[model samples]
Target: MRIPNLWVNVFIIFVLPNLSNGQQLSTKPLKLTDGQNGVKSIPYRATDQCMPKMDAKRGKTTYGLSFRLHSKGGHCDDGLLICYPGMLNRHADSLGFKVKGLFQIDNKKDNKVNQFCSFKMQKEGISAGQTHWRGIKVYTMPNGTENRQTMLEASVASRPYKLGTNVGQFSIHLGGNGTDLLTMITVNDGKAFIDNQANLQKQFLEQFWNGAFLREHTGLWMLGLDLLPSMKQENVKLFIARNCNCTMETWFTQPTDSSDPKEPELPTAGSNNCSIEFESTSEATTNKNDVSDECFGEKHFEIRFKNIFKKCWMKFANACPNQTELIMLTMSRRNGFENRMGIRQTWMNDSVPGEVIRFLIADAEDGEANDVQQKLEEEQAKHGDLVFLHGFVDIYAHLHLKVYGGFKWQQSFCANANWVLKVDDDALVHLRRLAYWTGKKFRPIVAQNPLVFFGKLYHKYLPIRNPKSKWYASKEMYPKDMYPDFMQGTVYLTTPATINAILLHSGQIDAFYLEDVVYTGILAELANVTLSDQKKHFKWRFDHFDEKNGECEDGVPTPFSIWGAEKLNVFEHQYGRMKSIECKK
Candidate 1:
């Protein structure tokens, strides 16, 4: 059965003098608003610095090309290459810098005359995560005569390289992604160059984002190479993503000078000259390590800042039959009657006595052709599990309200429940396994005031600036490049105290449409909520793209306590497998 939602937001603005451990909370009430952050979203205004990239119109189209490097006895004898791979600027601004996607310069005195050659190959239009090989070109000075000449160039790999002396050529990459231009490789001879300094890496990265090197509001990538002179050769790589905020990691052979060959320090992922609230994550003490980071590839270590939250959720559980130990608040649409019925007959029915499940729906999301509200009332009369919320339109953008409202609802009424689970109506929750894990894992921690916030963590992520994206965030809304680590909002678990912390903190910051990012990430950081980081224990119940691809073979029962956001038929099938004694976990 479900609880009704004719409830008002309760705010205890007074200071708590009798707080546990003599601790006091002086906090305000959560007042969520859609901060009129979209005045110029039509023609967005950017108040922050932007990155520079290749200016197509500002830079002339060269008529020629060349690539010549001198290698002797398996060692590079000459070549000096400096390639700044940047975005292909479509803007006609005078501040833009002209760069050929491919170029080569002969700095070698052995080449007689100091020759500078530059040209364009193909228009830069590659996408992120794709590596391509194209025939590149550049116009060179030829001999000492500065007339004009064209010479074609070559690339060892997709990466741009420079050997030594005046014997080298420059190579650049162009990408379809705004923030990502190309994957550039710079090979240094291990000298006293500015690029070798760790701080320079940060500066170049800064120039890449701020308008210092490009036009305002632009976000692009910059690559700097600082190699140790001692190492014969090393291969370092970085993969850029859509938001240009992927975790940077690599494995390389030690440079020759082992003493000072430290990993090059990079600017915090997605961070630039500007500051946002809690822009960088302070590390949190978790009992588990990140099992999810494997997706980023091999890394010796990852930088984690300190984020220590005060442990709060305490022992308040007794095995009383009527005592509701867990509250599963499923966010549902007002007209999602079919989904509700599907869940009721599936995982929702797999509940034990101490668990309570309710579907939360916004009042505004109801019927045109059908009387959704009346049918919901009838459904409530039959099931008694629907909680209707007021005061917000149920559009996709305002979905974050579902989180904030649902959490507010949880804290106000179900504070006594040992744990609170938030799930989507499309999600799958293995109540039986959750019940087992509660006793085996979660209960003990809850007994001692668990510092638990469980869900899959999206570690190094950047907010998208492209207006075409549904998740687009403007500078007025979220000016920061990186969002604090947030969970995939499909499902998450927390205790009453954590919810209180989040709610209070939510009152302190401006709200955004992306609820998981604002509440789960932004508020979660301020609340100091550390993730459970048990990724293998929680996952996505992947469905095949084609249902026709599915066979009538024996179904596999999922062992996870939660794996979610599934379709109706898949939910019913999985639920059947969960009940069948013949299925293996």
Candidate 2:
């Protein structure tokens, strides 16, 4: 059976107290406005400054709180309580707040305490497991009433206590602990609590609603994540998803030198192994040496292989025509869905003649419907490389010429063209370096083994569950190591020869919903197409940006065509700032 929604979120809302400051004594109860989808955020000032009366070694007290309405009415229900402590946002507004530090509520409810979370923040300095607590609990309604009621509380055992304050607009996340005794007291419905702040304690205990109140206000559900400090250096990313709208942000303790450093060890398959295995005495000793060599050898081997392979692939594809070319083969008569915008934008963006461009627009059935035929005619008129075939027969791009389309073109054009860029309409492509990379040469660039990419053992790892996901797979259905360095769908490419080999072997490949990994990771494995390092492949919006330019460090080459942020104003401003330069040839 599937897990319920409320329970899943309970897992994501783990709470941990901040240990940097002395403990607080009479910290004012931050009235959380129920059902507002609010967030609570506070500044963490870590200084040598010590509290006068409290133990100097304990540090200063610092903390923040977030309030929200539970629902229109109230009820006896349970939810998760999460505390995001030790998140450092150097880029916080002049006042102080990091662009990063979003905490999420999982709501999968499979377990009250999760083994691992996508984002975890810890406060430690060069120590093994210093002051870091990543744990969750269950929070239940305080008292029975007609309206919403709040029941939650957290206590610090340290010398002094700290409370979080608001400079701009930020809210801390609070949910349930494992215990039944609720510490937080809810006041009036969210609005009243904000209005009558002076009498919060009285109103919350007296005017709070009961079970019926919560049931009626289904309210918008929200998700959040936080970045914390661990091992002296803080590297954390947080995300918040509310009402299906997701926003992710990242926070780093401090900025590091931007110059490239000597490469670190290559990521290993079992580096994330969470299992505890025991080996026999004699065998264990022998296995230790073997394991060491394999682990060390694998890391070194991967690094060397990547550098050598990247250079070779760049050299191999340098012989194509000097100019750029695009080929489109369409059979649809008319644009049936608004989804066609994906393809239409690409064709219109850079379809100049004498640029090795070609489109083989065709219709298999002679004008089956009005919409389909109209789309076909419109595209055919725009591009001279239009070809219409009656039946489902495979032909080259043009009627007589076998240029190629779909899987076949992977081979046909790649062999002759400098770069064979193929993309789906739903995707946005960044082509600044693609053209440049294609002109260089490399040894046969191949994909790593999908099984190895996923991990040494295929069916052992599990995905962290979330109530929002409709297609959550169980440990049984997806029992493989989450494939690392898998090719993403939407945008990818390789040399002409590689494409030819992939296309020629397409018949033997089975399709997977995640098409990119299936074709490139699985099928490409048969062709020896290993994973390549391309940091710009896929990324989220709030990941981070160049500190100076404010533009994404790895944004698509084109200004106006970059992905993320549908707001017209933001896109236009960013586009204007992204100075256009001719593709480096």
Candidate 3:
């Protein structure tokens, strides 16, 4: 099965309950507004009467909420809590770089999130002097006027957050998984470290450190979102809130009844200026499978990264083990920070002998202007096992460019390796099992047949013309209604000759978006290459064609060379179970 792409991304700016005690960072400076005389503002820490919804139903924890400010009819408007800092730049005790904005989350579904928000603290509660996490007193019957219940008050304690950290839940945050921080501080970027090296989260948090305190620690009511009621539609407003603590002093921005900031447009069609839209979503999990693009219950597609091949700006010299028996080349997402790190720790654990595991991904989808580029740079220097193809981005739309781009790089750099095992970041290659079988079984087969192109092969798969479907292909791209025989990019192994053949014919054909068809099917057919089928050795469960819909489970047998794996946490969670299961005859 093909790896799914998520339309809605998960938030990654949260702190778990009871993990560690976070040190207090700053003190409250000045109040922009006085709520002392009935303005309804107070002081509250993430620890005080806050509800994390940890015990709530599974999938109940949402990360965003918005309501109108001082409007008629007391209705909620589509809004986002923007936690801004005093300045966008802060670090090394000097002025930081980058003009940052408040950490904001944009939730698409309008569900009633039970998460807390800033409101007037009510004295009528069973406890007399109690305030919510936002220092706003709870109201008895209902808080605020009927037309404006979920609203923010002006004070130094309104912690209006921006980015939601859904790392533990869905594994995406700030355009990546929290695991992307490489080496903490790198040898290239000059910066001091705490020496002992805290949770890589500290480095992750430092990305937004200039604009507000990201939730730290495991279980102390790590921040939740607020969902207010709505009356009607109107122009929305935004505020720059701050949370200063060491003593937990949260600050609120003075109310500015201005419309939301215009979202920046992303680059299109050869535009050099790439701007990552601030509204990238996570977790595109629909219940049923979206198999509109499949034919006869099978898929016939792979990525061919076109126009993405530029200069190799970031690379490791001879990182591919010379004359290694197997080379694992993973085509990963640019924002898949945790996936890359998870691969390094799991099956890529050097379990296979004479094999080198290297990840193949570009860093342009999320754009290099922000923290994504910095984290990638650090990860490469620290790991030195990554190959980031420069030039064009490797986005969902650039699938045609990334797959072939990876193979081209391998042909030029790591062509000496015997078997080029191409796989997706979401899939796990049982390195030990692969080695066991290749040496005892298929090694000689590939050694003799240098032009071997093998995997779960498919034939006569038709192109999907559904424009609404994620895998839609245009008639112009591939005029033929049916595709040629090809192997799935999920887990395919190719010899040096096959790689050379595919690259040689790359320039001869017109570029198409669907990668699997272009390279393995079209190009392989053009070069008169071999297409071997190895379906029984792999187990993939793509129940739903959802990117964040991971299928890693317990009690997996060790017989298969590859299993359908997804998500960062599941990879780590099942790594132990995967090792213990013995291959049954």
Candidate 4:
């Protein structure tokens, strides 16, 4: 998953025809080596002044190719080809070689080119109806051979024939054995196109391999062909003139002991860029309307909350003298008095000694109901656990600020606690079980390694684009189709150190609509915090809970530490039933 810095360079030679002015072509081949952990990269450069001039009207396209090899034998079993337009300079000339090849499979009867090699353009962004490109293909081995093959490809229509610039940029990505011959072509338009016209090709070759060293005498070499523009017709010449740059990275894994031929290949999730479509959307496009005035204000958000928590801790120390081992912070709406009371009567009261529970409420926005603020103040006076954020508004769009405020509060006030469990007021939490897991089971791990986050996790989930959906995220808001690995928002667990890291580095990240994606995905990634999927800790639906089947009769479900019980009756029923059941030794 991670690439290393050391690399081996390999050289590629380009042969250019002599012009009327009599410039000799270079015959020496450029030599470069490959990198370790199955990675090969080559930078683009121009041999002479013959580099392509940037096109003013049409922008340049950048291409990437990734190759992955699973087994030890010298063959390319898996790969991907990616293309992005308008990513590079059009006029600059560089040094690189172009690659052209047929996707072939070795059949016992005959070796033939696969019909699936034809490239198709992929649609970008989250949308209602779009064609899904099958960018990955697997070919089973013929008769006696044990090896299988996989190939991925994508291409675009070439630009129209221009007088000055011929080729803009090209690169090759190769994986597996260096000797597994592939068809390659070389073309030179001469120094006239290079010097006055600023026309030359730029190409890069990157290769990734399995962990072991490949044999030197492997047979995979690219077959090279020469091209001349003068001999070809205008239409055919235009097609050949388009630039190609690709990144080829191959994942090489050790062989498995299973001998069944029908066994499925290992899942390659993040191996290629072909999985997600690239659009021209920027970060500012999606975040334009979502930016709050609170973000720009001079108030130190973290410092203000730190001061508030210090005062609350003093009050808590006088009321309850026991040192709290776990702090549970619930996100509450200022108007949701019923939900807060329902939580307090049921699960909030179930916490054993050495555990603390509290609600985080924010002020109502300007021009809204004044009665909600009056009720929150009364509730804070009655229940000493309420921590109110002063300047922030209690709204769905501003949830990131509220959550960050909670993290800062925990880090400042409850820094001695081993774990901080964040849950919503609508959810049902098995606090006794959570306390046992965090304190008795997971405490040693946190003491040694403190940057751990545990919760129900979402991986590679595409953003919802439907306007009617509650979680609609426009392309302008989030350009990528898939979000990074993030914890589910309903209930998740973290440590004091991770909370501090998120608070310290959170200024660098722009707040998005989804607090889970913003805090756990984006900010956590920037902070280098480790995320873990607690499969049994969080459940999306409570439909499976049946008292007859001892689901609620026992302490929650086997893996479910928290359930999304939005209704008060559902929370009370489950909590009452779980309480009646006896605990096993």
- Specify the highest-TM-score model's number: 3
| Per-residue alpha-carbon lDDT of candidate 2 for residues 1-585, written as tens digits (9 for 90 to 100) | 322332232232322222244442332332222112213332222211112123344222222233332222112122323333322222222212322222222222232222111121211111213222223221323121112233322211111111111111122222112121111212322211232222332332333332122112111111112222221222222211111010111111111112211211331111111111321111112222232221110001010111111000000111123344433222222242233433344424544542332333322221133355445444433332233322121222112112223334323232444344443333333333333333331122322222211111122223434424533333333345464234444344444555555545545643323334445554566777555645433332323534244323234242222334333344334333333423323
Per-residue accuracy of model 3 over 1-585 as CA lDDT, tens digit each: 311211111112112222224442232222221112122222322321112222122211111222111211111121222321111112211212221123222221221221212211121122212211222211111121121123222112233212111110111011111222111211111122222224423543455434433322211021222111011111111121211100011122111112221211321111111212222112222322332221111111122223222222223323455667777777788778888777887878755556877776654421133466667655655565666554444666556666765676566566788788878887766676666666665677766766777678887788788867766766656667898998776777788778777777666776655677777888888888878776655545433322232222232332444555567787876665555554333
Global lDDT of each model?
Answer: 0.41, 0.28, 0.42, 0.43
Residues 192-271, model 1: lDDT tens digits:
21222234324534554332332221111221111101011111121111001111111121111112122234312211
Off by over 4 Å in 3: 1-314, 366-369, 542-563, 582-585
Instruction: Give one digit per residue, the lDDT tens place, for model 4 in 1-585.
Output: 423211211112222322223332322222110211111222222212122222233121111121223232222212232222100112111112222111111111111111122121211231212211111222111111222222222221111112121221112212112221122211121111111111111111222233322111111121111111111111111010010111222221111101111211432222222122221211122232332311111112332222111111111111222387778878888777888888888887877776787787764432244456556655654565676554334677657667766775665566777678888888877777676566554677777777878888898888898866767777656677898899988888888788888767655654555889887887788888888877655666566645344433144434335556556776788677654544333
lDDT pick, better of 2 and 3: 3
Which should have the higher TM-score, number 1 or number 2? Answer: 1
Candidate 2 segments whose C-alpha is farther than 4 A from its true place: 1-372, 384-405, 410-415, 430-433, 437-481, 504-509, 537-585
Better lDDT candidate (1, 2):
1
Ranking 3 against 4 by lDDT, winner = 4
Pick the lDDT winner. Answer: 4
Ten residues in sequence with the least summed lDDT for candidate 2: 306-315
Q: How much does each candidate deviate from the true structure in C-alpha RMSD?
A: 26.7, 26.1, 23.3, 22.1
